[model samples]
Target chain A: MNVPAATRAIVVARIRKLWPVLLVSVAAALFFGWLYQNAIAGRQAGGEVNLGAPDAWLLLPTLFTTAIAVAVAFACTSHANRDPFALVEDAAPLFGRERARANAIIPVTIALAAAAAQYAGARLSPHYATPPTFFLFNAIAAIAAMLVALSIPLRDGAARILYALLACGSTLICTVVALAVIGFTNGVAAAKAGLAYYPNFNDLWGGVAEASFAALIGFIALRQYGEALARYDPLPPANE
Target chain B: MAILEMRRASFARGRTNIVAPISLQLEEGGTLHWRCELAQAGRVLARMAAGIVKCTAGSVFIGDYDPKIQPVQVKRLVGFIPHPPPSNPFDSPQAYFAYRSDLWNLQCASAVERGMRIFLALHAQPPNLALAVSGALLHEPKLLVAENLEAELFDELANLRGAAALFATR
Candidate 1:
């Protein structure tokens, strides 16, 4: 069958939606690399890091918490909004199933779970600040949620794009907000006491606060996911 | 009365049409089949499984579930087939079933080991590979509708008679 030019266009659009996620995940990974270097090498990775860095690295898992949250939000949005395997899905193989509902809550739930795990884990293991384990866990959780949401069906071009935007943007927004709060609080000099750990666990408030938000975010996200699912339509004879 | 019913249902996306004025009905012993020579059959099947597309342009009834009013309920009765259920190469059959079973809400008493062994024995497929074909026929639902087919598949519909069920599939 001559593939419709329109189908090709949709494929391109899906790629575009996925691109930002790729870019951001890379950037976050690189930044975390620096954090690792600082913690291990006992020297700044490159230039100087501000002292009163106003960080929630103590309250949260810091780099990883932020990265995972952003990564997951983007992943779920993209998966729901795009026909990642459009050609195959359209073929209607025997006993094949397409999901009509997108579970936004799952990712958010995972995101919260990730944040909680990171916060609590980091707090418990304050000796090494880089906390690679926390970051790894968050990344895994976000990806898992995305894969699940992608199982659902989506019919609208606009809705797909919007889903991606929501997924990619929401956690980043949370991360930014967290950063802003940290900046406002300004890292207490004592916050740096865990140089062996990079960000110390002396301040346990971050883990608790971020974990709570993770729960709230997951709750709100599930509701939104369900709403999006409600909007799906498989065959569009009417619109045509 | 038909075990499954579809009224003048229509669906649209933006300005394009996806499903058009579709009306149909099925009794207990009916089998219907359709195949779209389009991109990604799995994606197409997924879209059909999701319910917001049906409109009063007519209504659809499945068992006691109404497509218009109880979409989630209809979803359970409706089994969608994706040719290839996604999977990780390293995952065991037990892990794969455990993961997807969470999504599909299959009977928990039905152990992953049992499901894997049954499909493996029936399909003669490898244990680790995730099969894309979603076996909705097994749900023994009061009503069911799905895409795609193999000539021999419905041949065994008789085995499902004990389900005392009603459903149709394409």
Candidate 2:
């Protein structure tokens, strides 16, 4: 088949194999969003909520819940990618890079979709003001989670333990970056100067910067994955 | 000219050889029934010959393409049917055939029709094996490699003139 046709086929097959798990991921993300809403429910105090800035402590639950949901969701994708019939595909007249790219479409789509779902779910909470750029941060975390998930080696003795460590490590880094970005965008300098309490933090430029950074990381990760697929041996020689 | 050739091709994991260095050739319309000392060894050797796994030493070629350097080209000319028959994930034969057609870039409807025809002809055979063989033949590959398949299947493959086959057995 032509490249486009073959790519379509691969994508269709992956979707067929992964729809159930993808659905589960979306549900899990939404569930986490619900938990975030409940975590900060006490801060509302039945008063008009300020749209300027949420306290760093209040954002903790959002970050942790979203990050954990994204990580677990993507880990399931890693398992699905290791199909037993992969040997059949390996012998096909398709480039490994092409196959990898095709295979990635579904996972990436699920990541974005699930992230959006979480954002939607979190938006329902009356505890905090939801910024328009909040979805962008969630998107970054979701992609990061996917990258960490795919980096895990399959069939290793301590794979589950390693997955947990990597998930936590990546989430921690993202959480720090997210907090810093929030501080910078919310006018940390302006707040310190005692000028405006919380200057309208609608930061288009900051959002663009965050998105560009995430896209760069995702591109590099996908390229590395494709190269690895090209040299992968589905059936290594037996030790005996 | 040989359609498939292995010059001392072997597979090794670290210091141990799984499929010992072996050489063989199969020309157009030829057949090679290679019997190995162990089932695992036969399985690995067949995969090497089919270009699904690279040989640790020496080389294997399909037509004029070296599997090590031109895996896609080699695979384009080869079809592999594994032993124990792969499980059928499709709900029906049509689904399976359509999937094969899409994967191989064949005429979708016609490929499905042809696959159904072949699948029906082997009605007495196990469903998984029949389905696998039908899928393997969908693209009309130049070479067919069977891993520990039954003899009756070979009778059917032999009837497909102009194609070469390699049957690996324990």
Best by TM-score: 2
Give me the runs in candidate 1 sitting further than 4 Å from their true place: A1-49, A53-67, A70-218, A230-240, B34-57, B83-134, B150-170
DockQ for every model comes to: 0.08, 0.47
Summed backbone clashes in each candidate are: 47, 1
Worst 10 residues of 1 chain A by lDDT: A92-101
Q: Which candidate has the top score in DockQ?
A: 2
DockQ of 2: 0.47
Q: How well does candidate 1 score on lDDT at residue B35?
A: 49
Candidate 2 residue-wise lDDT, A1-240, digit = tens: 555767887777777777886788778777666666656454545443332444455445335544544454445433323342454566678886787677667766777777776677777655445554655666665665565455444334476456546544554455445455545666575234221222333456545655665566567656766766666655532332
What is the fnat of candidate 2?
Answer: 0.55
lDDT of 2 at A170: 54
Worst 10 residues of 2 chain A by lDDT: A190-199
